[model samples]
Target: MLIDEMLHLFYPRVCTGCHSLLAPKERGICPECIASFDAFSDADAAGYAVKEVFRRNYPASNQPESAWTLYRFHKNDRLQRVVHAMKYEGVHRLGNVFGTLLAEMIAGSTAAAAFSCIVPVPLNRLKVVERTYNQSEVIARAVAGVLRKDVCTDLVVCKNHTRPQAGLSLRERHSNVKDAFTPSGNVVPENILLVDDVLTTGSTATAVMRALESAGARQISLATVVLAA
Candidate 1:
C-alpha cells in the first residue's frame, strides 16, 4: 500500500470517464461518474436492449437465451470516454474492472449461473497483434474471476480481419463481419457466455454466435458493457 501511495503521488490515477483524479477507493471510474452512467433499470433487465438488438438482427433460432449490457451509450457522453480509454488508450485492465462490475449487477440472477464458461468475442490475429491485447478477453477473465467460472479463449476465433464497423450502416456492418469468424478447436462447451466491450448493431456478436453454434456450442448468451443508443 505504501508503494501504491508513493506512485499515486507522482502519477495519480484519473477517472476514465471524467478525467479527474480518482479517489483512493475508486478504480477506472469514480463513484460519481459510475452513478451518472445511463444504467439499465431493474424494469429493463428482463427485456434488455441487447435482447432487442439480437431479435431485430437475427432469427429467434439464433438469438441467445438472454443478453445484458451495463449502460446506454451516446456518442459524446462520459461513458464513451470510458470506452475510448478501454479500447484505444491501452487501459486494458479497465475491461476487467468493468467486467467485475457487470458480475455484481447480475450476481444473483439466473442468467449469471446458466453459463458453464465465458468466451470473449475474439479479435482477428492482425488486430490482436496491433492492439497487443484483446479487450474482450480481459473483460471475460475478470467476469470469470467474479463468477468462479472458466474463460475459454481457444474455441472461437476471428479468422479474417474486417473493416472497422464504426460509421457504417447496420446492413453494411453485417456484411463486413459475415464469415469473419471461425471456431477452431473441437472441445467447445455446450453453454457459454460471450463477452464484449460494446454492442452497437449486434452484427458482430451475431456472427460470432453463429460460428460458435456451428462448432457445437448448444447454448450461448451475451454480456457487454454498453449498448449504443
Candidate 2:
C-alpha cells in the first residue's frame, strides 16, 4: 500500500485521452477528449464494424449478435495510448475503469440477463508468459465482479502464438486467427459475454464466436473498451 502511494505521488495518473493529469472526479480520459469521442458513436460506423465482419463471413441469419463500444480508436490519438498503456505498459488498473464503463453498458442491454458467464478473448501462451497477465481477462474479471457474473478465464485457450494483427488487412487478419482458439471442454452456459480490450477488424471476436458456437454456446455478444472506427 505504501509503495502504491509513492508511485502515484511520483507519477500522477494522467488521462490517456488528453495526457493531462486527472482532476478530482475525472479519470483515464479528460472532459475535452470525452466530448471529442462523442462524434464517433454512429452505430454503423463505430459499433457495427463488428457486424460488417459478420456480413462477409456469414449470411444475416448466421451472423452472431453484438453490442456497441464506449469510444473510438484514433491512430496516434489518446485513446490509442490508453489501450497501449493497458496492454503493454503495465497499467492494469485501467482495466477496472474500462470494465466499469463496460458493465454500465451491459446493464442497459436486453441481453444483460441472458449472460450466464464472462469469458475474455484469450492471449497466446507465449504472450501470457511474457506479459505475466492477460489484459482481456483483467477487464473481464472487473466487469464480472461488478455484474456478479461468473468468469471463465480458463475455458478458452489461445494455443498458438501468432503475429500481432495490427496493420494486417482484414483478409490477412482472418487467415491468421483461424482455429487459434479452442475451448477446454467446459459446458458453456446458454449466453456468454466475450470481452476484449479493442475491436479493430472484429476478426478475433468472430473467430472466438465460431469456437464458442462449436462448443454449443447459444448466444454471444462482443464488448470492448475502444473500437477502431
Candidate 3:
C-alpha cells in the first residue's frame, strides 16, 4: 500500500477519457467522465438495431444474435484519443478499463450469459509481430474475466496482412478484408461472442461473423468498446 501511494505521488493516475488526475478511489477514469460517456441503455438498445444488423447480413434468412456496443463513437473527441492511445501506443491497461465498462453493459443485456466463448478480432501476423500484442485480445480477456467466461484466443487468426484501413471507404474496407480471417480449426463453440475495439460500418465484424459461421458456429454476438459514427 505504501509503495502504491509512493508511485501515485510520483506519477498520479490520470483519467483515460478526460486526461485529468483521478482521486484515490477512482481508477484510470474519473466518475464525471464515466457519467459523461453515453452507453447503450435499455431505451437506446430497445430499437431493432441488432435485429436490423442480422437482417442486413442475412437478407433472406435469420441472422445471429443481437450485437451490443458500449459507447457511441463521437467524432475526433477525447474518447477517440484514449482508444488511439491503447491501439497504437501499447497502453494495454486502457483496453481493460474499456472492457470493464462494456462488460457491465453486456451483463445487463439478453445475451449476457449466452456466449459459450469469447473471441477477439485477430491482429495480422506481421502486425502482431510488430505490435507484440493485440489490443482486442486484451479487451476480450478483460471482458471474459469480468463475465466469468472463457476466452478462445486461438479460434480466429488473421490469414492475410493487408494495407492499413485508414481513409478507406466502407466498400474498400470490405474488399481489403476479404479472406482476411480464418478459424484455426474445425471446432467452434455453439454460441460465440466476437469482440473488437470499435465498430464503424459493421463490415469487419460481419466479415468475421461469416468466417465463424462457416466454421460451424451456431450463433454469434458482436461486442465492441466503441461504435463509430
TM-score of each: 0.94, 0.85, 0.88
Residues 109-170, model 1: lDDT tens digits: 78778788999999888988888888998998888999999998888778777998989998
lDDT of 1: 0.83
Error of 2 at 71 (Å): 1.6
In angstroms, the error of model 2 at 59 is 4.4
User: Which candidate leads in lDDT?
Assistant: 1
What lDDT score belongs to each candidate, Candidate 1 first?
0.83, 0.76, 0.77
Q: State the lDDT of candidate 3 residue by residue for 9-82, as single tens digits.
A: 88898888787898765666777776777666752472245546546644654354767677776778777777
Predict model 2's lDDT versus the native.
0.76
Off by over 4 Å in 1: 43-47
Give the alpha carbon lDDT tens digit for every residue of 78-146 in model 2: 667768888987677778777887787677667777788998999998998888789999999988988
Quote the positional error of residue 88 for candidate 1 in Å: 0.7
